[model samples]
Target chain A: MKNRNIPKKLQDNLITIGIVVVCYILVMILSATGLLSNLLQGLLVPLCAYIILAVSLNLTVGILGELSLGHAGFMCVGAFTSAFFSKCMENTITFAPVRFFLALLIGGLCAALIGFLIGMPVLRLKGDYLAIVTLAFGEIIKNIMNVLFIGRDSHGFHFSMKDSLSLGLEEGGDVIINGAQGITGTPKDSNFTIGVILIVLTLLIVLNLINSRDGRAIMSIRDNLIASESIGIHITKYKLMAFTISAALAGIAGVLYSHNLNSLMATPKNFGYNMSIMILVFVVLGGIGNIRGSVIAAVILTLLPELLRGLNDYRMLIYSIVLIVMMLYNWAPNMIALRKKAANRFGRKKEVA
Target chain B: MALLEVKNLSISFGGLRAVDDFNVSIEKGQLYGLIGPNGAGKTTVFNLLTGVYQPDEGFIHLDGEDITRLKTIEINQAGIARTFQNIRLFKELSVLDNVKVGLHNKYHYSTVEGLLRLPRYFQMEKKMDERAMELLKVFDLDGEADYLASNLPYGKQRKLEIARALATDPKLLLLDEPAAGMNPNETKELMETIRFVRDHFDMTILLIEHDMKLVAGICEELTVLNFGKILTQGKTSDVLHDPEVITAYLGE
Candidate 1:
């Protein structure tokens, strides 16, 4: 077991990387063969973004054992921040990649700042109350973004809440954000490759955290709070650590998402309670605290509707049925017993053969 | 100086004095016991000492440093570690991982070092793993190191919790009803384990137990409590034979 442990650590990381590489290659192969339709190919970046969101959300929901309904809010912060930065940099930065990297940095930092601020008061509340506070925060951020107005001029930046027109600017000044309308004319710089890279980075940060001493402290708090505290685990520090990192990763997803589109909106419908719940569903279906499960569940669920396009009216019906069945298979006692029996039978047959 | 000294410690929940004017002075390397019947506040005193609940009025000095109002984790870092009345292992984690959690603060690697998998992170982690295995070996749990802590049998789980607490390298250890559900044989073994921990670690131990037989064999000094106040404190045998202590355990 001594030497085996080293390879075991590598193996854990390899599986996530392997899944990403395999998916990327498979998509490329399909595209090369003309088997992948234009619409499906277009879905790749968004799919990767959601995979990051789901995996990061698992850090909070599954590993940290906290119910966070404001994930969409953090994503919204990142999306708007990055989009605004890209809009401002459109004429100045000739290289698209450099501009996108800057956007990502600003977006991640802004989201982490907001996460730290929000987590302070919100983390004090537990369970349902925490969930409600975060839900309310998401809605608040969305509404705030709707009315916010900012534009750049020779005199510097101006901001107001009334309307975009309120940011009276010099002629030819860039209108970075239009109230309720969100950011427009942003470059479509996000691509499948960047999305995959960000996903891998997110996996690296999260998996490494889980294998570190900090990760142990965070999980211990989840497993047994009193005992963890007794062992000198500072509950607040570790909780905020996971929460902030989770927010930062979601911010990365947001940057990827905003750059994928020519225009982005912080609409309530896009970053609201429902969006939060959807991400939570991804984490739950993936199996709480299971990173590999999160990646697989996110991919399958994200692609389910497209895969069931032939079913049309029954697409959602089939999706719901699949979800229920998957949950039962993962959790139901009789199903578990049946699975064990099948495995045993297969083992005996292999032995006899 | 005594390793742990508590004076005039008092706490009230609503109107009831859960632990009133509790006092104990435990010297370094001593094995002490606190015993009483149900609702006698044995656990409450442990809670106060560990800073789970701040005393309404009192002072607690550990190694001559004041720690009365310190937070729970701070007290732990200040050289006090405890196990729960109900075993509180990280149920889903492997046994080795459970002990490693206790070794968390002992390492100095930054979060960035951990995230980037820096050499310092691996060095410290390997050391922690080796140490965790040693602790498990002491408890005869090394064979089951990879098994989930919840999957362990009851006696083994109890032993694992103690092994985990010991991983903190505490100067003072608190065991709250360590033999609560153990049978006679298991309880006897627990007695020897406690003795081994005290002798080998050279640390002060304060435990609460219902089994007088177990306490008498190991604890050199004992205190009996009734209704949140100490009824008697003396040699283990004398405390057990006291008339007031008998009445507290039995009836009026």
Candidate 2:
């Protein structure tokens, strides 16, 4: 009853944050007590990255009601840009935290810029068309990154689409990005703590925006475009705003991703259509427009494969089954009714107590 | 001056003239009705007035300013708000948020301020909530303010749409078939609500409806359209009794 004093929205946001904090605390305690396996420990930062990606993508797919299949492209933009910056500033900055923080900003801003430019014409297209276009853009970004080359020496930085040798540099020139090979020796400034902090920040921005005036406008457009227009909600502006912010947050995830790896590469397995679909799976299985659901789903789905590694040959088979079950649980009509019934009964019990 | 003035407004789709040379002048605080048979371009006229469809020719003047060239959002900002023939509530949003969306322009805060939870965001949101609740109370929907808009009963959804439109503080309001699917009892209540809205808000209303009972009960003036042309315009009782209007509605 005391909880009634807080707004329902604020209370929901608090519970989501609370779930994250509780999980973080549990993980910390286990790691400190030597109960956590190294393999699980290694998954922590990446888990944070996926959570951020899922939440950010939800901003577009769930809340904004746009299907985008090019999320990995934004992530690639963030990863490469931040990786490039960190490598160049490694010797000069001499401070890991400050350098990493700046890289995060650079990564997010670059992704946002790309998102804005792409959203300008692309947002005009709705439904399946937008999805296809975004999918193509994702591949284009990954391919472009594959053939990109940059080298730095005394005379600024040299760039080329060809091999590293084409980047005509003077003596002692360092190749930061060497086409296909990608960037290496980037300072590993990302950690579990940073990842958790970024997740919290992402949640804060997204949840607050959803509860704000702008969020209402965006949601209105999603619910009914023509009605939203008649009510005077600027369609293009809100669409682009949500798209850009979603892209920027994805970029932050990318920064975390690249920094976690010893070497960053734009490969088909990593920053391609597959990666984009994987993030989308997280969003869908989580429940579209359900923010906390995205976090939980991302965690479970990401950990499932790793947890089932001992199952080996049957691993994927079980994974797909889990995917199907989760889909039904979240979206199937019968399951929805059952869930409602169960919730009602549970509420009655609580009241009786 | 008329609150809404339309002069020779027209539009065509492909080969068909959906609405041709439509003309109407509604004085301040008057309850006006636009009635027509199916495919008579009644809703199309509503669209033109609300900027859902740009007139092929002619002008629309609201209060003294021309708004014919304005975009949909601009038209709303110029103080015209409308509800759709189909209940187009934001189904996923709560009833309160649906109205809050209507109050969006009246309340202002930058995206940055909202994201950062600045004091201005809090102040503006508080003001919006109070205003939205007051609007909801007018329709007796305050009790279900937190329910999803789609969860409301059919009659209540129609009322919610009207309440949402009013949140814009519009000089003119347009309702398209507000009683289309309602039972007679609901229509009777709707007529009372429409009359109350006019008297309480001192508002000008232009509604497109097929419900003759609701129309005759609340509307002060009536315009009947047939084949994209105005068949007649006069006081509610006279228009309903006019032979030409009767023929247009019932066929010769």
Best by lDDT: 2
Write the residue-wise lDDT of candidate 1 on A1-353 in tens digits.
Answer: 12224458679788888989898889888899999988888899988888889999999988899999889999999999999888888889969999999999999999999888888887766667667878898999999988888989999999999987778888988778888888888899899989989989999999999888898899998999999999989898899999999999888899999999877888755687767776777887888898988899889877877777786577546556766887898789999999989988988898899
Query: Which parts of model 2 have CA positions greater than 4 angstroms off?
Result: A1-6, A311-353
TM-score quality measure for candidate 1: 0.95
TM-score of model 1, chain A? 0.90
lDDT of 2 by residue, B1-252 (tens): 888889999898999998888889999999999998899999889888888788889999999999997999999999999999999999988898999999999989999999999999889989998999999999999988888888899999999999999999999999999998999999999998999999999999999999898888888999999989998998999999999988877889
For model 1 the local lDDT of residue A267 reads 71
Report lDDT (Cα) of residue A24, candidate 1.
88
* Residue B72 alpha-carbon offset, candidate 1, angstroms: 0.7
Q: Please list all clashing residue pairs in model 1, or write none if there are none.
A: none
lDDT of 2 at B187: 93
Candidate 2 residue-wise lDDT, A1-353, digit = tens: 11111287798999999999999999999999999989999999989999999999999999999999999999999999999999999999989999999999999999999999999998987668779888999999999999999999999999999899889999999899988999998899999989999999999999999988999899999999999999899999999999999999999999999999988999987899978888888898888999999999899988878887877567557656777887899889999999999998998999999
Candidate 1 docking DockQ: 0.58
Task: Give each prediction's DockQ, rounded to 2 decimals.
Answer: 0.58, 0.61
Q: Which clashing pairs does model 2 show?
A: none
